[model samples]
Target: MNALMAPFGGWNMPIQYAGIIAEHNWCRTKAALFDICHMGEFIFQGDFESGGLEDVFTFSVKSIPLGRSRYGFLLNEQGGIIDDLIVFRIAGDKVMIVVNAATAPKDFAVIRGRLRGGLFTDITAATGKLDLQGPLSRDVMVKLFGEAVAAIPYFKFITMNILGVEAIISRTGYTGELGYEIFIPAEKVCELWDLLLSDERVKPAGLGARDVLRLEVGYSLYGSDIDEETTPLEAGLEGFVNFDKTFVGKEALLRVKEQGVTRQKVAFEVAGRRSPRHHYDICSAEEIVGNVTSGVFSPVLGRGIGIGFVRPELSAIGTPLTINHERVSMEAVVCDLPFFKDGSVRA
Candidate 1:
């Protein structure tokens, strides 16, 4: 696999293999395998209440049923997002925290400081992750693994034996397709990767195709769409935040709610083939309202789709705007998310 490699989150990552568009299309029609070993994993074991784990994130950890996972944010004192991550309830008292690779160190330190009694450990060096996504993903997994893989519902996971070792197969994915994220031992990742690609229906995809796939479905990229300076409210991710929970940033978020958000996240579609790039100015009329956070030419829609922050008044659907970068300019309009809505994500 002669993949074009690039630096991402302090690691040399594959940008594309074959071609970005080809790989993206393959994933839409068949299963696409992704090497997601760069993601960080942490294990926490203790009492949710006594260990102070319940208040660590925007969602309640104790309330997460066993064998299920929940997505939410970790906020700083100012109510700004530190990172958006998922917590998997592995057992009654043990949970696994999955986070972005680049923020692993900071996320671990912050989480440790907040905990009083839980036994927390960074398992990134020992854990490996792989994602198989598309409408055919479940079939591929079932054939390779067992019927157990076919039983997992969305957001649920089960521990099963693979390659003579325990592995977690979760029915969750970044692409808006029926898929699974498999967590296994780091030592066996190479073997697992080879095994999955051996299937004729499965093709390897790189981060380049992965980015376009996620953006098409309106999934926010960590460093791009949401970051430490961006609050969940402004990012339109407040649904993941539980206001009843007494989290670290509750007071600040309450304050923000009262004051209202100054800017809000919006999705837009370009009128032509011209792509919008990051940092491109988002203009309403003649005034620049915000900048593009993430943008790409969507193959599914045959147009450019982007996610960016803009003034609230300029974020309504059908609001006309201009995307400008240096000498490049394109006409665009605010649109609903999931630009490609006919995905098999729920099916």
Candidate 2:
């Protein structure tokens, strides 16, 4: 397990084991194990209504049923996305909020400031998260954990005994695969990792392969594709925002909805194998209209796939664009997302 380690979100993380492309391909065909213990986990226990938890996010937390999870955004007063996170309803009065590693501190502060009565506590130091993702992930998990793991539907979870401790196994993932995200005590994480890797069907994947896998499925990266300066409306993620709910950023989003966003997120494919890098200029008719946020050479499509923000008029499908950076240039065209669509996510 001699992995190339690098700094990510203030933690030393594995960037690759064998290679990025090799791990990416292994995940597409078999099972891939990801050590995601760096992510932040918060526990909130109290009344959903009076505790002020329901109005903190873009979606209604109280509406989430027991054993279910919801994905939404935490927004600032300006309608800008603070972070994209998932809320898991563990019980009637308890929920676990999972957030990106780098933004965890600020997110905790922001959420705490908004709450009036809920008992909120940061559990990241005591918790560990591992994602088992890929087409064969379900089979691998069921064999190791038991048949109960097979019954958990997408966005649902169950609390069970594992490694002599209570663990939560959620049927959720970032890779758009039929996978599971297991939350266990930090002390037992290493043992669980070793146990999972003992199976020949599972291979360790690093952040590099995770990045490529997420991009192929059109998932936005927190720091890159979406950030504090970019509102969910401009990022083409307004669907996650519930207008019916009274949230912190509702007014700003309403204003944006009325005035319309000048720039919008667009998915594009390069004409060849030349990958579009972040910060590359996105041009239309030789005019720089926007910039690339995230880009990668997609092995599935055998082309360059990118997510960028451009003038609304230039975001339509099939619209011609040119990505340029210094001396490098590549022809591209706006295309639908999920450049690779054969994922076994819902299977």
Candidate 3:
């Protein structure tokens, strides 16, 4: 392979050009860059109802205001998530759906199969994504893309000219900070990367750093924290689901709600340096309860943090627990999510 490759989601991807921790620290103090070309972007060019796009997700696509985006999931008949996505309503008949990289092909096929009418196209290869994230993201974007970039509100986006080409800049990101996700032409992505790096405050970051950033803020990793076997209600993600709309998994979710969840997602923190990891057994005393879905060593909190599933009764603050691996065990407690409370996510 011509490009650097490392393991991710059973695929080899680039780890870094410089280093992971170097990139991580840069994002915290200054601007850290990211190349997200592996993400999937799809365009649906038809009215929400006519195209059957409105019912595709748990929320109404047509109700989303113009130039704004909403995050939610596509569910199967059993109420399990097909994928988590952000939908940007660019125009009346034009919507941009951003999907995760690992589920790109399956998401496209499933979404297309559900649509009754419309011009649907998977623009993954033709589109390129980059994230310039930090407290200084606005300033950097404003400096390059002009005032239009500076005016975008949180969760809102604008399609404008960048580098003389049409591009979309949204004030949305995985990190709990002021950031922008720029969608530009595939060919111009490298150019934008070079231009953004010209600023002293901007430095390139990799997916490794991105993962840490997102996790630090309690943001759920799609495949890890959720899957086809879990419902939004059980995941503590009911805020993203619309009860007013009829969508796939609504019935299943209602049923799950009535039945009460057997298990729910919970966030916990270690009292010391040892970190929890995926599949690490969670236990109250010696009996295994659940497994850690996602975990990381948090730089901001100076402790290890993670999210996992456990019995609802056991999910409580100050509950003492232990994370167990084969020959490793760590003392942990069930603390609140977002161990790092100070963030510019909504700023």
> Model 3 over residues 1-347: C-alpha lDDT tens digits?
12345877544566675666677777877788888888899999987897788889998898899999999999998889989999999997899999998898999999999999999999998998999998888888888878988778999999898888999999899888889999999999989989999998998887888888888989989888998888888788999999898888789889988999999888999988787999999998799989899998988888889999999988888888899999989988888878777877677
Backbone steric clashes in candidate 1, count = 0
RMSD of each: 0.7, 0.6, 1.8
Overall local distance difference test of candidate 3: 0.88
TM-score per candidate, chains pooled: 0.99, 0.99, 0.96
Residues 21-52, model 2: lDDT tens digits: 99999899999999999999999999989999
- For lDDT, candidate 1 versus 3, the one ahead is 1
- Name the TM-score of candidate 3: 0.96
Question: Where is model 2 more than 4 Å wrong at Cα?
Answer: none
Question: Mind giving the per-residue lDDT tens digits that candidate 1 earns over 9-88?
Answer: 88788889989999999999999999898999999999998999999999999999999999999999998889999999
Q: Candidate 3: which stretches are off by over 4 Å?
A: 1-4, 7-12
lDDT of each: 0.94, 0.95, 0.88
Candidate 1 differs from the real structure by a C-alpha RMSD in angstroms, to one decimal, of 0.7
